[model samples]
Target chain A: MVKASMSGAVSSMLNCRASSLVLVLVLAALGGCGGASVSVPGLFPVPLVDRIPLPMGLHLDESLTGYVHAEELEEQGEWEIDLGSAQTQMFQNLLSGMFDSVYPVANPAEPGGEVAGVLVPNISEVQFSTPLQTRSDYFEVWVRYRFQLYGRDGELLGEWPLTAYGKADEDNYGMQSREPALQAAAVAACRDAMAFFTVQFRTIPEVRQWLLTEAGGPSR
Target chain B: MIRWHQQALATGCLLNLMLAGGCVTSTVQQVRESATGMNETESVVVLSRKTRPSQEETEADFVNCISKSMRGGKQRVNVVGEQAFRDALFPWFEPRTAPVNASDLPELISQPELAERLASLGLRYLIWIEGDTDRTDSSGSLTCSVTATGAGCFGFLTWEMDSGYEAQVWDVRSGNLAGRVSSEAVGTSYMPAVVVPLPFIAPVRSSACSSLAQQLKSFVLNEG
Candidate 1:
């Protein structure tokens, strides 16, 4: 198919040159002179995007995951792998593996409200032009999550905007594989949101009052 | 230690041979709000309900039926205190996903329709003003004031309030925020009752349309 398209381009280019030369060369050919060299055509190529870069400071949410390959990543509410609903596991796993990062979290019971902190990320809303006819598949996700900690009295302290980019692999498109990717996407979304809260959690008066005055909070 | 042929014939109860992980479960409950709007019309409508808060002028039976806690036939009940919905034999109910197209569909739900219903019940302009209590609640009396500022309350993008909504009034004929009247949306669920998550508390109203109208009228007509 590729060869056929290439040849089609070459022939069209030749047809154009032939018509132009016919007027100039007819009388020259009548005098038995040789003709000019053949030229190659510049074909239109499709745009291709190979990979999307991961954002910074977004910790993937693997709280429901069943397994984690790397022990260093073994933390409460953190998992390397998780079981996804049936019909798309492999694809999930591929996406999840891509999101190897951490999320900054503040204690919700602190004197002030918690803040969103640093987290590694895996997804983004800003998209590039789609690539045509490769084995890879793509889906777009637009996320809007707030970052910052507020108090009982509604005082605002710190805030940040979280964003991410996400993709799943072509080979393992099953539910299990895809579960990783889905989680990676969610984690990437939360990273920026978490970062914002990290700063906001400290000084928000409402948060402080809620933490200090409220019972079973700082202890819990 | 070898007891020989004395191996007892034992039977095992096949318990699901896996340990269940720790969990956090949440339960949702449905409740109604005492709706107050800045529109002179909203107050009169709320006052007409049978279960309406007599002392504080609050509406009742406006349950949050859409909450996750609702089960089976419970989801079918609208509970808006209408006579048809109230009748034991004819309990009316509604479900939703998106805002109803009030302009095209006569069945579409909107605040104007609610206002019309209130108007039918003889209350023309029951407006409820919204604002924070500048002074702390003291001596069992609630003292506060609401403010609505803009061009005749023409546009409603968002209240710009931290948690709840505030309405700004607009002239429907001229299409501008009149800045003349307005109301405040009071969300008291997240209030500190016993600390903790306070999961039992629900939003003040299930009808966002009715509340949105209140916001507009409150901000435009009532806010100082």
Candidate 2:
């Protein structure tokens, strides 16, 4: 980048002085180092369709879930934002993170060993809201997460709600930046939600049995 | 004769400057349009536009792109990832939920609000980068018996855009404009290697606005 800068200077001097091979040599030294779309798949213009009605209130229809869909929770009398399709992506990212947190569990059990029970939590609703909007300028995210549980047999274990949120208020300055906190809060919310499942599933009888009998490990 | 020579030279230089400026500016304008691969769509001509002052140009670029094309078919702008940014760049410190300085960041982009409002009216997903996209001016005057060198010279108001993007994915069905995500980049521009080069940087620079308009020509046409 500076090469251009020096060149601009040298060129001007050369035209003025009429002679300087020596400086020209130094000029080349500058040029030396320095420096320097997504085609959505299977995408096309299709007839516009809106409002995907979830049949069982458990799983949303795939077709209508393509875009970010939102549904306010009338039950809790609160506004919950479900990215719908986007949540699937968020869930995948969370699983990858959990694997990183507890590395071994993330790994596929073993070659052909017996399989143990699995727990999959379906996050039905999530939201960042306020009891009432406040003007206290700080990085505070009031997050509420709602999820349903499924057992390995693909049977409905129990669908309950769990909540864990964070409140961090610090100015984004010199070293630490604000964006990271906002991002971490979101990811942490997802992770904590996973952790809650881990804690709960560990208490289940079938899960406990599977862990001890199959994986050679068990806890009361 | 010397005076005449100087005058002639000055006139030639002026003309060249304007001519070169036109070429450079037009090339800049073509930047955004190159991404969309469109031209002809009336949306292209309208959206690829800008107002004066370079400071807000980046913001203007995004606003123009989204607002101009907002009406027709649903639109989406891809922003860089958030975690990738924090991990790669700001390893030492990152603000937690407790301490976010509001003054540094714009109070509200009004984009999401506008997008949400539109969702209720029947629009699709409305996307935006989270806070920190806007650059922050870091230079200022601090008087002292100091080295004085590099001191008090920070005059220009500016901001360096770090990383992050947020988009409100709306469900027009339930009429809930809920889904929101913000992402950031490790460096200024997104990784072109991971993905194709962005048609152009969002929120075109003010000085380069006209050129951005020219680029939109191709993008609008491609949309067809």
Candidate 3:
């Protein structure tokens, strides 16, 4: 009877090993197939700034209004980020707060005579890095923006590029998943872009000169 | 039936086992650079230092813990939410633009608009927390396996954790360094497995957060 019991215990141990292997295989399969798609929130705080006493026109092309980034990494499945209307709305709030008045222009080539000058904003590049890629505890995002200035007569005056960065710590989020952390980082990058532009807009030499002329009178 | 002495011996063994598993120690210290007090209308905010990129920042949950803890209890005072305060004073309190020292407050509040905003919030103090919890040491290992009928584990594991945090209270209204409080905690957690793994986790970080919050509350209240 003792020998029989020993044989039974050995069989049980083997069965346990097989079951554990199956469980691990199932979890690995699920984890390997899971990918994330995140839609960033458009909400931004209206900055407190002394508004310039000049009416301006803002031209937002479809690229800035409806932007989406999609990529696939080896063995990491696929990722998609839909930033639709977030950038457009952010710029709308920023410009309105910065200038006395801002009106949308249909075409930048022929901006009407109602505005002092026309401002055109474009997204030059967007890049992101995951914790797995950087071997860090944070997910980071970077956005590059270029602002073009046009006189009321539709002449390109100057173009300036600004780069903004944001990061979110993985430990701060629940479940420590990729979607929420990535979305938070993306929102932070947008906020950083807005803040940098608001602070540095008047500091640009060309924009400063244009502001002086436009505010002083409609000479430019 | 089991004898009375057997029952007593079993109870004693259980108590000893519990005592062996529960091992967490903590310490708190403070320095008063200036006197501090708060009225009923005045409030405070706890913010983690995020300006330094090379240093490990205090966890968000720890800040939240301090805020939440000080908001309740008998000695509880008014506490402003960190995110709301940052959002309301955007661009100014941001990581890139925030003032590093109390001396910068004169220039910071020089703007009439910012001063007015500060007045509106009745914000009296700004507490900046810095530090993090880390796994100091770890040893042993535990292995588990599962079968269709049940699961079992066999091994032993133990790990040591250490938490350290410091809070610098800045009186925004006066633009003076009010005081500083620091907390430290160390603990060892263990998991020993026979047929099933039994885990005994020591609350290292939680203990540090509690001690820091309590000291901060009293420090702001100017109480012993």
DockQ of each: 0.01, 0.02, 0.18
Per-residue lDDT over B1-224 for candidate 3, one digit per residue giving the tens place of the 0 to 100 score: 46988989877965665576567899999999998999998899999877627337688899999999999889888999998888777767766677888878887887776788888888999999999887787666545555567656666666677899999999988898898899999987665557655566677888998899999999999996
Cα lDDT of model 2 by residue, A38-114, tens digit = 01122111111111111111232343244322333232232222233444444443333222211111212121122
Candidate lDDT scores, in order, read: 0.24, 0.29, 0.78
Error of 3 at B117 (Å): 1.2
When sorted by lDDT, best at the front, the candidate numbers are 3, 2, 1
Q: How should the candidates be ordered by DockQ, best one leading?
A: 3, 2, 1
Question: Which wins on lDDT, candidate 1 or candidate 2?
Answer: 2
**lDDT of candidate 1 over A116-204, digit per residue (tens):** 22322222223211111222232212243334433333344344444433232211223222334334333322222232333233345
Model 1 misplaced regions, further than 4 Å: A1-144, A174-220, B1-224
Backbone clashes in model 3, listed as residue pairs: none
For A1-220, candidate 3 gives per-residue lDDT tens digits of 0011111111111212333533443343356565578988778877766678888899998998888888887777798877656877888888887788999998877998889888899888888888778877677888899999998889888999998877887777844368898898788788788878877888888887787777863221
Angstrom error at residue B79, model 2: 28
A44: Cα error in model 1, Å? 45
Clash number for candidate 3? 0
